[model samples]
Structure formats: structure tokens, C-alpha cells
Target: MRRRFGQSLRVGVAPGALALLKTSRWGGAAPELVGELAFEGGSHPEAIGVALRQLLQGGGCANWPVSIVLADELVRIWQVAPPAGSARLADLEAAAALRFQTLFGEPTGAWKLSAGWDPAQPFLAAALPRNLLALIEQVCAAQRAPIVELVPQFVAGFNQWRAALKAGAWYGLVQQRVLTLGMIDGGAIRAVRATALPEGADLDWLAAHVAREALRLNLAAPARVAVSGHAPAAWSKGATHAPLACHLLGQGQGAGWSDCARLAATGSRP
Candidate 1:
């Protein structure tokens, strides 16, 4: 019989602000494609596709619940691309279901979809058609509710951390998302606010903004702040502040990835 287990993988795409995730209950080895496979690979989707083709040649099972978020522009571009076997963001739900059935014989749970902006924007769109929403809703039923809104940056940070761990290195993880005060029960994140970042800003500025927002929302200071896709040295150093850890994701399991599963298990949603 197949093992009854679960794993969550986050993908942070390059050349665009897309933080994606795939959480699964099957015990098969994961797809070896590095980062989230949603973006057009930053001026060279063809090159990235070549790399993915080689990776998939090794033959790993694709049974998983996938979630993706990317800049709207990238989605529009890939939608028109007629490359062989290429899938668009709009086709994500069907693709996910097919991948799930092919690998695990059934869908896993709800796919929490979120996005992050390169320069944080005021509005992000959730463009799911009703059919896709129903499919996602079915899969999510077996999982935990997301305590922390699964934003693009956090997913990106998780992906970087996963690659680092697979490569065998210890590195800090950076997540560039808006922070709202969330309750933590026994070290697990819960009931947090989620939002996008502003334009043309750095992690340092983001941290300051989070701190201020926490205060305004009457929430306690974050336990710590970790950043990726940018330098962590830029974050403000002050007493009575969340310990800031920053590093690029390429090797070693970071704090965010280490705790993500527990967070997911705690807040499984349908």
C-alpha cells in the first residue's frame, strides 16, 4: 500500500515575482524542476524549458496539489506561447488535477494560491474560474488552514530553502511579504494578515513597514524577519525588534521551510 504522508514544496520563479507551492500527501519523490515552473523563465522560457525537460527525464511522480502566483504580464505572455506541452496559468487547475490523479490516484487537498509583487502593488487579482475553485476547494479540505497567508515571497523563500537543503547547505531564507500580526500557538503561525508590498522598495523598507503595521494593528512584534531575493544586511538593527535573518536561497534548509509543514498541518483548509 502507498504510504499516507504529506509534503509541501514552494517554488519561487526568476525574472518575475511569483511564489508558488505544491503540498501533497503521497510519498513519491518530488519533481526535480528547480523553483516554481510557472514563470516564462525571465527572457528565456525556452532555455528553462530545456532544463526542465532534462530534469523530468529522470522520471519522478507528479501527484501533488499545486498553487502558483506570478506577475500578470508573465501569464499573458505564456498564454500565447504554443510551445509543445506548455501550460498557461489559466490551465493550472486542470493540470494540477491531472498531475494528482496520474501520481496519487486522487487529488490531495486545497491549494492556497497567493502572489507577491516585485514592487509591492495595491491590488492583486485572483482569477480562478468557478470550476477551478471547486477543484482547489476539494483538495484543500484534507489540509490545514493557512495560519500565515501563503504569499508569493514566503513561497519563494520556501523554494529557495528546499533547493538549498537538497544541495546540502545552511543558509538564511528571505520572504518579502506584508506582515500582519498573527497568533502563534506553540510556535506555529496562525491568524495572520496578508497583503502585497509597495513599488521600488527593498527588504529594509519592508521590515520597517511591517513593524509599523504591527503596531497599528495592535499586534505584537514579529518573532523574527527573514528575507530572500535581496540582502538581509539592509534590515534595521534595533533592540526590541524581531531578529532579522536574510540569505539567498540556494542551499541548506532555512527557518521558514523548517516550520512551514507544521504551519500547513495546523491550518489545513478545504
Candidate 2:
């Protein structure tokens, strides 16, 4: 199971000197807070705090965290696993919150924000109640972002759920092990194609796969096609695939998140 929570800020402070603020995810308006500091610096922590206060006073933006709801099953798994480096879930949660505070050069109590988690998995059809769906549908309909694609992990019997999308809505295509399609009305995916490249395949072979897939989909030369996963790096910089935008692994956050907000919201901290 996975848990999700939004971030409000991540502040880093230098020893008794400078403070820097970095934005987390979940783009939105963020509230201000006085977070507690957990530090070991001699005179640095105090100096850092002063620096942070000045920085904020000078008109700086506070970082916001992304909200990600976790699945229940995943929670149980973490509970049983031995804590990493002798630290239990609680310890990690506290540390994470403190890290944000210290990074911003704030004194103890400079960057703690509330974490919100939904009990039911919002992404799942059966778990999403009518009220929530209606509320979300209305919100999504109003979005001007043009597209917001949600590429859920491929699970058995997933296609059965796609029928719920509204008409004139985007189409969903299942191509082998991957699901590729457009997310908005004006934006088109051009094509959704997949080809399996053996473990040891070279860039040339991969480019061939891309070429073949592009042709099969009859996709117009996409303004840009981003390729991600473990294999993209294998392609040469100026190789034939250069015409397309390729990246390893889809874009977003990293794989490992020691985020306690997500954990606390789901009641799964580990």
C-alpha cells in the first residue's frame, strides 16, 4: 500500500550564517508556520535561525509539500520490516519534520505543517465515493492546466475501470505492459506503442523499437516524445533517437521518500 501527503517547505540553514528555502511538491498556496529545530550545531543553529528570520523578512517564498495518499497494504509491510538503522517509524517522522525546519535556518518550531490523508484510496474506483468523485470531477473540469495524466500502476483488471471516463474525453490504450494515452482534449499523445528490448539491447536496437512504435501508432511527429525507464541512457546523445525527447524513468518525485506527513496521515509511519 502507498500513502500520500503534501509538502509545505524544506529549509536548509548554514552554520550560524545563511539559510536557504527549497520548494517541495503539490503546487498550491502554502501557509506560514514557525517550525521547531532539531539540531546539534554549537553556535550554528542559533546563527542559522537569525539568518532565516531575516531572509523571510526580506520577502521570500515558503516551500509547499506535495500530498500523496498511501495504500493500506503498504503500511502493514513497513510496520513489520526492521527499522532502518535502528530508527523506528516515529523517529523518522520527527526527523523529517525537523529537517525541514533546520534546512530553512529557522529556530526550533519554524517549519511544521499539518499533514492530511484520506482513509480510502482516492485513485481506486470502488473506494471513491460518489460525493468525493463529484467534488473532484467539478474541480478537474475547471482546471486550465490543459492536461493532467494519471498513469496508475498497471494492475490486473485495470481496463474495466476506464469506462467511467466521460465522452469526448481522452482515450485509454493498453499496449503490452504499458498504458499510453492523452490526458486532455487539446493535447494528443500522437501514439501509444510498446516494444520489448532484451536486457542487453543496445541504443540502435532501442531506437528501432521507438521508430517502429511511432509508425505503428500513426502518431504525427510529436512535438516531443519523452522516453523514460532504465534504458533511455543507453541511447547516444546525438543518436537517431535524438529527434525525440528521451528520459529515464517518468518525471516526478524520487523513489524513496522518508516523508512522515504521508505516513502520519495514513497511520503508517515506518
Candidate 3:
């Protein structure tokens, strides 16, 4: 049977900001953006909701599957060993809950959980707050839109450049207040650390933190570094111990959160 092309809505949610885009593909062609909602922002949830509702109403997105791309700071991610033996999803959830509780303490019952494992790689589990997700769902449903997926921005960004994450390489990504640094070995993530950057942080501070993390992780000097989301210019000037080559996302020196949102909506990574 020939498949029918359906439009999908992608929503990128970050601190005080939200962006929306509609993507669709016809026949065997690549997916393309068909519509976009103006970027919306507010300091509070009620205000943000109002903006989202207004945008949704005006965007004419009806009966479409929505995919949410959350900021890295909002999504908790962990890498763990796969459950022993043939375990069901429920078993994995149980294990994930334990790990979450250990790290965060107390289950709020307001979080959604998901876990996945690839062959010869450690399991990756992620969680999103259910209350916020429900709010988005309610808003979209009111406009005849149903949400189909929710992904963390980092995971989506990684998916965009998975081919380049070679073994023994280090990567750093900055988005909003979050700065993520990690190592990849044989295309599998070896170690990762995500830190919150203070407002008005400078390149020196960022470079220093990167160096400290490399030391803490016992990672050797990186041969190359990948940066995204408002990365400082100094990042390309060999800011680390090694004279490292740098790769910037998109055409410019940094990446936009919307790119990650679009990738999350159309690509399969998380």
C-alpha cells in the first residue's frame, strides 16, 4: 500500500521561549517546513500558555501530530547498563525509577519516563515532567493536535551529528543555561556531564569548566570539539589544553534550538 504523507508539528521549548514549525513530505521527497509559528515567550507558565494558545489558534495546525523538543536542562538523562536477562518495559521502568530516585530523591509521580538500549551500548533513559507535558498536550488537543513524541534537545542535536561522533572524541554543546560535555568511543557515549551556566558567563569561565571536566573525566586532550547554541568565539581558538579543531552547528558559529526541534520531530534518535 502506498503511504500517505501527513503533516507534523514540531515544538521547541526552552526557558522563556517556544518555537513551532510544521513539516511534511510528499511522495518520496524530503520533508520540508510548510508553516511556522512566531517565537513566543513569557516569564511564567500561564503567560507562556496564553502565548502558545494564541500561536496555535493562528497557525491553523489542526489534526496534526505534535513533537516536543525540550531544553536540555528540563530533561534528565542517564546512561546505565541494560537490565539483566530478558526484561520487559515495565522492568526497565522500575529500574529507571530507582535510578531517578537515587539521583533526585522521592518520586513525584509527575514525570514521564523512557529507556532504550542499543546493542553493545549502555542503556539510555530520559524523563520529562508530566505536568508540563500535559499542559502542552492540553493546549494542542484543544486545537485538534495530538502529540506523538517528546525528546531532549541534546539527544536530538546529537542525532544530527551522530556520524561525526567518532571514537576518542570529545564534544561540548551549549544551549540556554546548559553546557553539556561528553566523550564518544566507537560511536557509543562513554561519559557525559551537563552543567548549568550562570547568566553572563564569559568564555574564560566556559573554557575553564571544560578543562576541569576533562580532567575529572580523565579524558585526554581532545583532537576535536563540536559546539552548538551560542558557543563563544574563543571555542575555535584552541581554548583547551590541546590545539583542537572545532565544528560548529549550522552555517554560523552556533546552532539554534529550533534545529534540534526539527530533528527531534523528523529523525529517530530518542
Candidate 4:
């Protein structure tokens, strides 16, 4: 097939599936190629490697530059505060590792840790399984496809559409039955949480859940929670005694590859 759009592929990796989409990108028109492979069990690195290999082969997308979103389920995201008077990159790294261990009860040696590191303030940090990351790298290398970006779903969503958020409204990402929320105040993120959604969950559930999270954290639930992702449209049409409001956040200021700009590309490899 002739290349119509730029050979830009976007991948979404979930525990049960690997989804590939050849986007009509860089403002060019092209035949859309979308494919997915579904399997049982967790995204063990080898399993994911096989699935991705199949997806790429079937889509004939090898050699294409790619961007990927790691599903929230496969990622651990949390906020960590740098110690008082913290000033070095090592200080922030140590803080993030300690916080990760405290929260997840595990050493950071097995996980690849990266974050918006800052010495002056708390920032969100993430962990990706080392083997799983290595598998992704190996597959990308074999295909000679550069990884243009790799990020968690929640991080990518926040990075793209945060400017559209209403002042003081909490931010959320709802996708694939997971809801990740960020409680933001005055330009700093107070907390981040990712939770599983129950079957048929609706606005009432969302409101009560948000309120519960706020109570647990001593936050006042915002009057609105601006959500980005595959949130149900019906959520925007109802009124209830719900404690908070939800509206789908609009399209982002992002154009082209900014859609997945949170993580820098794994540097060029041999």
C-alpha cells in the first residue's frame, strides 16, 4: 500500500490487548489502519512482546515511528514531595523512590522510574515494569521503529488538555473501566488516584466516589471534575444531588504528536 499519511503509528497497551492505529497524521490524509490483539492474562513482558510483534506485522507498520500509551492499569503513578531544601536531581530521585516504596511496598530496582522531577515541589512520578519496558524496546529495535513517546494514559491526558480545565475543577481520565483523577489546587497537584470502575457506574457513582476520595484525603471535592477520555456522554446530561459536576473536556491545544507528549522518546538506539 502506498503511504498516504505520514507513517506515524499510535499504540495503546493494556493488560489484555495491544491496539495499533496508523493515524492520518501530520495533517495528511491516509487509509486508516487499526488493529488489535486480545489475549488472556496480564501484560507480561514476553506476552506483550509477542502481541506487539503480531500487531505490527499484521498492520505492516514496521519501520514506522511510534508513540505509545501504557494503560493506567500497567503503570503506578503517584505524587512525591522533595525533602525540605532539596536541590539536586539525586534528591528528587531518592524522594520518588522512597515514596514509591512506601506506597507500593516494593523496592524500585525492578521498576523503571521516571517523573517530572523538581527539587522545589511535589510532582507526579511513574513506574513501568523493567522487563516490560525492555521488551518494548527490543521490539521497537527489531522493527527499526523509533519510539517517539511512551506515557501513561493519565499523564498523557493531563499533559494535553490541562489548559482547557476550569479553574479549581479536578481533572480526570476515564478509559477502559479505569478512572484516574488529579486533585489540583493553585497550579500544584495535591493528589492522584486511579481506581477501578464498577459495571454500569454513572454520574452518581462518580460523584459519590469523588466525594469519598476527598473525604479520605481531607480535600473539598471540587464543584466540577473535568474529564478527558472515553467517559460516557450520558454523564453530561443529568442532574442529581451529586456533590460534584462532570463535563467532558474539549479538544486540546495539542496538534499532531502532542497528543502523547508526556514522556520523552527513549533516546536514539543503535
Candidate 5:
């Protein structure tokens, strides 16, 4: 049985920063930003754990159930064909683990995997390093913060944008040195890809990548692209023909990174 909690804390863990928000009703109202913390160097467990400790101490979130949205670099996501029959959970997990090892050349036994399936399309699975999970669990435990969920940043972003996504349209997201492009048709994801951006790469490069990936996936030009972290104009000119239509993720006052946090807080799954 799941435990019920009154207030929830949502944390977005990126390469070198953390975005925190608090909400009382999951999916009911927009989450309020508690604070954001930045750390030097890459996303090391020790560094992130220390920052989390400090944030919890200062932000009055020690008692809330926490849901984490991990940066693309920290989590691995793969879209695979759905299981054929009524396969058991264990069987699906084993298959996903095998695929993970084949694609990334890493031993899946050492990683923690979570798979989400949709009957109409391929299943999406996310993997995280067990050591990283252990580090986060230890830190949260020390702070008396219970972690209820952990999800990929793309999954959280998609959930926040799902309502805005149109049937047969393409969607692209660029954030934290990563770019994710996807196609949604009839309210279901058809094809998706996530790639890392090179150091100091500009929006033009990102636009080209998105366009190329969409073409590779045999998707039509997006009706409108949604953007975050940078201005939409950055991608508009380089995205094939005329300036592409773009929608800034946080278009108004109540949107932004916190929208991702709000989705996570609400337990929205991919």
C-alpha cells in the first residue's frame, strides 16, 4: 500500500544544479519555487548530496515526500517494442535489462531499471546507476526526507507538455546539455530520441539536430516547437524552411522549470 502525504517536494536534478519546488495538491495547482542550488564541477553524488542537505536545511522541506527528476546525463532512456503477450513484470524487466546492456555496453545488473508500457506504442524504460540511487537515498534519509519517486527529466517535461502537444505533431526539448525530440500522434508517442549537446554548442546546432532526427524518424515538420532554457528564436532560423513556430515552455508567469517540478510532484508517469 502507498502512504498518503499532505505536502510534496519536487526536485529537478540537473548536471550541476538543483531546482526545488513545493506543492500541496499534486496536479491541482502550480508548484511554488522553494529555491535552486548550484554546485561546482560535474554531477557527482557527493557534491549533489551535500547541496541537497543544505537545501533541505534551509528550505523547510525535510518532512515532505520528495520526487526527483533526473537530468538526461544521469538517466538512460530507451524506447523498445512492447512485449508480445501477457509477459510478467520480471520477464519484461529482464528483457529491458538485456537491451540496455546491448545498447550501452554496461552491465545492467548494477543499474536500477523502471519500465513504462503503453499498449498502443513502444514501451519506454529508464535506467539509473544504483550507486547514484544509494547516494540520494542516504542523503534523503539523513535529512528525514522520504523519496516517493524518481523520474527522467524528459518524462517530467513530457507530462507537463502533454496537454499542449497536438496529434501528429513533433516536439523538441533542449535543456542541460541535452536535446530530446519526439513525435506524438493520437495522444501517444510514436518516436523519440535524446542526444547530448557538445560543449558550447549553439541553438542553431540544436535546431539542425532536431530537424535531422525528425526526418530520420519520418516525421513531418513540427506544427510548433516548444522550448525551454533558451529563447525559441535560437532554434527558429536553423530549423529547415521558414522560421519554425515555437512556444516557449514557460510562456507566462505560472510556467517554467517549475512546471516540470509540478508534474513530478503530481506523480505523472511516462
Candidate 6:
């Protein structure tokens, strides 16, 4: 039988902080707050190791299923094209590796990559440091927890709210001061970029940013941007004349949220 409470644990890992929410899959009640931890430094695996170690040592989290939500900044995400009708998995992997190296100037040996493999069009690829991935898994295992998923927040948001997104709009996920933008056209991703947001940024800023990205990539800009995370209030008002409309998907606050984004959407503090 399933536990009465805390049936699942949703762990959100950002650059310098971690959030833990315990959710009951069988109940409609709000997810419970297990904990939150903040630390200094970038998204180094060592920092993540320390945070997870502390959280799991509480004893309350042991044996519960875990789902890890990685910030977009933690994972290198990019768009990959499979070179026309060649859909062989090997070819796709090679192409993704090359593109990842080109975009990040990092070798692929220390990272593990996964992508939506498709032959007809472009797909998205995500890479996470091998050591970081292993550390998460090992830490959870040591606590007798089974990991259900280790996913990027951007991919998680899209999977949960794809139907609600505008069909032709550029897609973005905003969380932890980062905006992960995905350009989709002809039912395929053309680009995936995660950029840090500047303070006081508003709808005008979003419009200009999208317009500029389109110009840089030489792709026709979408008429709207569908954002699935916490969109500021300014994005929803007084932008009808703007070149691009900011279409907010999912809730901006409260208990209603994708499990992967629950901690972020709530703005929980340590």
C-alpha cells in the first residue's frame, strides 16, 4: 500500500539552492514542504552533493520515490538537426554531440546527452554532467529512494503544458532568474537557449529579446511567446501592440503546478 503522506518527493536543484516538496500521488491536497536549502557557488556537483546529503539524512524522506528537477542552467540544452531523412539513432547522437560541443565549447566525454530523436526535423538535446547525474542517483539510492525522473525544468514544463501552449508561438520557461527559450516551427525545435534575466525586465524586454533572437537566427519570429513558469504581472497587461504577446501558461503562483516546477512556482524560501 502507498504511504498516507509524502508518497513522492520532488526535488528542484538550481545553481545555488535546492527545494524539496513531498507530494501524495493519491490525494488532491497540496504538496507538503519537506525543506529548502541554499548555498554559495555555482551549480557544481559538490554543492549539490552536500545539499542532497543533508536533505536525505532527515530520515523522513527515506524510501519515498524521488523526482529530480534540474534547472535549465544546470543542463546544457540545444537544438539538433538530424540531417534530413537520416534518422539512424547513431547519426542523431553524433550530430547532437557535435552541436553540443560547438555551442558550449565543451567536450562530451564528461556529460551524458539525451535528445528527442527525429529524422524529419530538428529536435532538442540536453546534456548533464556525468558526475552530477551519478551523484544524485547514488545519494538517493543510499537512502533507499527510487528515482522516477531526472529532468530539466524546461522539458518538464513543456511536457506538462504542451496542449495549453499556443501552436506556433515560441516557448519559454522562466524560473530562478533564467529564461529558457525554445524556438519551434513546423512541429520541430529550431533552437533552445537559456538566458539569464536582467532586473526590471518586462514585456517590452521580452518582445525585444525574442525579436532579436529571431533576427540573429534568421528565422521568422513567432507572433507570441508561450511561457510556462512564473511570468511577471507586467507580461500580461498592455502589450497588445507589442510585436510579440506573452502568453502565460500554467499558474503564476499557488498549489497548482507541475510536480517538477512546484518549488519554483511557489517561490519557496530556505
Please tell me which predicted candidate would have the highest lDDT against the true structure: 6
Which of the predicted structures, 2 or 6, would earn the higher TM-score when compared with the native?
Answer: 6
In TM-score terms, candidate 6 sits at: 0.87
Better of 4 and 5 by lDDT: 4
Better of 5 and 6 by TM-score: 6
Q: Which stretches of candidate 3 lie over 4 Å from their true place?
A: 1-8, 22-48, 83-88, 118-120, 196-211, 218-221, 237-243, 253-270
What stretches of model 4 exceed 4 Å from their correct place?
1-7, 28-33, 239-242, 250-270
Question: Residue 255: error of model 6 in Å?
Answer: 8.4
- Please give the lDDT score for candidate 5: 0.66
Off by over 4 Å in 1: 1-31, 34-130, 133-191, 228-270
Local distance difference test values of all predictions, in order: 0.34, 0.30, 0.62, 0.73, 0.66, 0.76
For residues 45-144, write the lDDT of model 2, one tens digit per residue: 3433344344433433222222222221111100011224633445444544444344435433422222211222111111212332233223323421
Give the winner by lDDT: 1 or 6.
6
Name the TM-score of candidate 5: 0.74
**lDDT computed for candidate 1:** 0.34
Q: Per-residue lDDT tens digits of candidate 1, residues 230-255?
A: 23343434524343332333322222
lDDT of 5 by residue, 1-270 (tens): 122466677787766677777766554555667788877756787887788778777776666788887877788878766567735776677667777888899878778888775543567788887877888888889878899878776777676666776555556666645567666655556666766777655555555665676677776655556654433444544545453555556433234554334333333321
TM-score of each: 0.30, 0.28, 0.71, 0.84, 0.74, 0.87
Q: Which model, 2 or 5, shows the larger TM-score?
A: 5
Q: Which pairs of residues clash in candidate 3, taking residues 3 or more apart in a chain or in different chains?
A: none
* Model 6 per-residue lDDT tens digits across residues 134-155: 9999889888888988887778
Winner by TM-score between candidate 3 and candidate 2: 3
Q: Which regions of candidate 6 are displaced past 4 Å?
A: 254-270
For residue 231, model 3's alpha carbon misses the true position, in angstroms, by 1.8
Off by over 4 Å in 2: 1-23, 26-187, 220-224, 239-270
Q: Candidate 3 residues 213-258, lDDT tens each?
A: 6677665656666765555555555445344556655434213435
